[model samples]
Target: MSTEPIDGAALLDEVEAFHRRFNVFPTEAAYVAVTLWDAHAHLLDCFDSTPRLAFLSPEPGSGKTRALEIVEILVPQPMMAVNASAAALFRAASGAEGRPTILFDEIDTVFGPKAGDNEELRGFLNAGHRRSGVTYRCVGDGATQNVVAFPSYCAVAMGGLGHLPDTILTRSVIIRMRRRARNEKVEPFRARVHEKQGHALRDRLARWTEAARPLVDGVFPEMPEGVTDRPADVWEPLIAVADAAGGAWPARARAACLELVNASKTDDKGSIGIRLLTDLRDHVLNGIDRLPTVAILERLHSLDEAPWADMGGKPLDARGLSKLLRQYVTADNEPVAARNIKTGGGVLKGYYAADLSDAWARYCPPPPESPLLPLPPLPASSQP
Candidate 1:
C-alpha cells in the first residue's frame, strides 16, 4: 500500500478511470464509487470490528450488478460473492477480518415476497446491522448441535429494484443507479486488461485505508441537524467516512444525506393534500374560517378557475377532500357545530382545520399588504 494520503481529487480521478474502463455512466457510477470508497474507509476506522451494508438500486438495466462486480475487485480484504444464507452467512461473517465489506447482488430476490422461504436469512440480515449477534441451535442427530453465535459486523453492498425491506433499508447506505444516456460512451471492460487496472486501484485504496483506519476506529461524528428517522442511523458512518477523507467529502456527505437520505418524505404525485390543508387553515385565520360543508365544496370548486385547477386532476370535492384530509386531520361521523353555520341539514358531518395556528404559520404566514394596491377610503362616516 502507498504511504501517501488519498485526496478527494485523486479519488475522483480513480473513479473516473474506473467508470471509463467499466463502461458505466459517470453520474451514476462516480457517486457510487466515491460512496463505496468512503464506506470502506469508514469501516476501517469506525467499525474496524464490524461489517457494513450498501445497497445499489436503480430501474431495470441500470448496471447495478456490474457496479457490484467492480466493487468486489476494488475493495480490499478477502472478498467473496454468493447468495447469503442464514447459517452460511453467520459463519462467514463470524470470522471476517476487521472492517469487512460484503457485497450481495440481487438482494431483492433474497428479501422480496418470496423471502419467506428464507425467514432465517431475513432475520440474519435484519440483526446484522445492530451491534449484537444472533444465536440459534442446530437440530442434528443424537445430541442437538451446540448453539452458535456470530458477530454482526460487516459492510454490505446489495443491489436490486425500487426499495429494500424497511428492516434492511433503515440500516444501509443506498446508491441509486441511473441508465446511461444514449449519447454517452464508455470503453469496453476487457477482463484481461481491466482486472489488472482494478487490482491497481484496489492497492491504492488499501493503502489509503491502512493510513486512515487508525483515525476512525470506533469513533463517529455527530449527525447534522434536521436529519431524522432511520436514515440518520444508516448514514452516520458513511458521513463519518467522508469526514475522515477530509477534503470535499464532508460537504459531499452532508449533501448526499440531504438529497438521498431524506428523500422518503417527498411525494411526486401532487400537492393537493398539503395545499388543501393550507387553504383550509387560511380560511380559518381570516375569520371567514367556519364554512358549511357546502361552502367548503364551493371553495374547492373555485380552485378550478386557474392555477389550483391545473395542479392535478379536478379540484377536490367534499368526499375526495375529506378522504385526503383524513391522513392528517381528524373528523367525526355526527354533525358538529361549524364556525359560522349551524348543523341540522342532510349533512351529517364536517371538519375544522385541526390546528390553523401552526399549519398557517408554516404554509401561509401573514404577508404585509402590498403597497401597490389602492387602499379603500376610511369608513364613509369617519374621515382620516
Candidate 2:
C-alpha cells in the first residue's frame, strides 16, 4: 500500500474503473460507490472523532447487502457485522482503536413496527452520533458498576427495510437501491480475484482522503436547503463529505439532498395535516356553497376514507364538524345569524359561503360548468 497522499481526480478514476469491473448496475453501483468513496475520505481525518452512518435501502432482491460487502473491503479499519443487543454494540464500538465501521444488516428489524425492540437501538444509535461519547452503567461483580463511556464517532452502514427509525434516518445518508432487470448482467464477485483491484482503489481513496482532511475539518458546510426535520441530520455528514471534495460536488450534494429528503417528505400515509384538511374543506365549499350542520356532517361522513374522516379525535360528527367550521365563519355573514339576529342559536353556528370564498379560490378554483355534455350510450348491438 502506497503511503503517499492520494490524487482526488485519479482516485475518482480508479473508483470508476473498479466499479465497471465488478459493479453490476451502473446507476445503483455509481451511487453507492460515490457515497462510499466520499464517506471513506471523510473518515480518514479525525476518524476517532466523527460519527457517521449510511443507509442502503432497496427493493427486495436488490444488491444492497452486496454493495456493503464491497464497502467493507475498501474502508481501512476492520468492520464488524452485528444484529444484537445495544450493549454489545456499544462495547465493541468503545473498544475499537479508531472509529470502527459497523455494518448492520436488516436494521429495520430492530426499528420497524415491532414496538419494544426498536427503543434501545434508537437510543444507542442516537447517542452514538453525538460529538461527546455516551456514558452508561455497566453491571460488574457486586453492587452498581461505575459509568463507562463509549466513542460516539463511528461509521454505520445499514441495509434492509426501506423506512428506518426517524432518529437514525435523520443522521444517515440514504442510498435507494433498485432491482436488477433481466437483461443487465454482472460477473460474479470473487473476493480473491477482485481483492487486489478493490485494495488499489481503496488505497488511492484513502490517500485522497488524507489530502482532503484539512478541507473537511475546516469547512463544515450547512445543511442543504429544503432538507428539514429528521433527514437533514442524516445527510449532513454526506453533504460535508461532498463539500470537502469541491468541484461539482457541492451542487451535486445539494441536489441529492433535496431529491432524497424531499421524496420522503412527500410520502403521505393518509395522515391529517393542514394541507389535507385545507383541501378537503375547499372541496366541500366549492361543491355545496354553504351547507347546514347535518349537510356538512353528511359530507364529512361521506369522506370516511379521506384525511378529514377521523380528524379532531372523532369521526367528524355534527358538533365536532360545526366546531371546526366555526373557526372560519363570522356571525353577521351567516344565514342563520341574519334570520335570528337576537337569538344565540341562529348565530353563525357553522361555516358560511362568504367565509369559504377565499379558501375556495385558493385551494379549489371554480371550473366552468359543462354545457350539453353527452352521456355514454349502450352498445350498438344491444340498442338495436
Candidate 1 lDDT by residue in tens digits, 323-383 = 6655542333332233344566644345555333444444442443555878888997898
Best by TM-score: 2
Off by over 4 Å in 2: 1-5, 16-59, 114-116, 133-135, 222-224, 227-232, 268-384
TM-score of each: 0.63, 0.65
Summarize candidate 2's per-residue lDDT along 255-309 as a digit string, tens digits: 7667666554444221232333354454555554555555555665676457456
Residue 192's C-alpha lDDT in candidate 2? 91
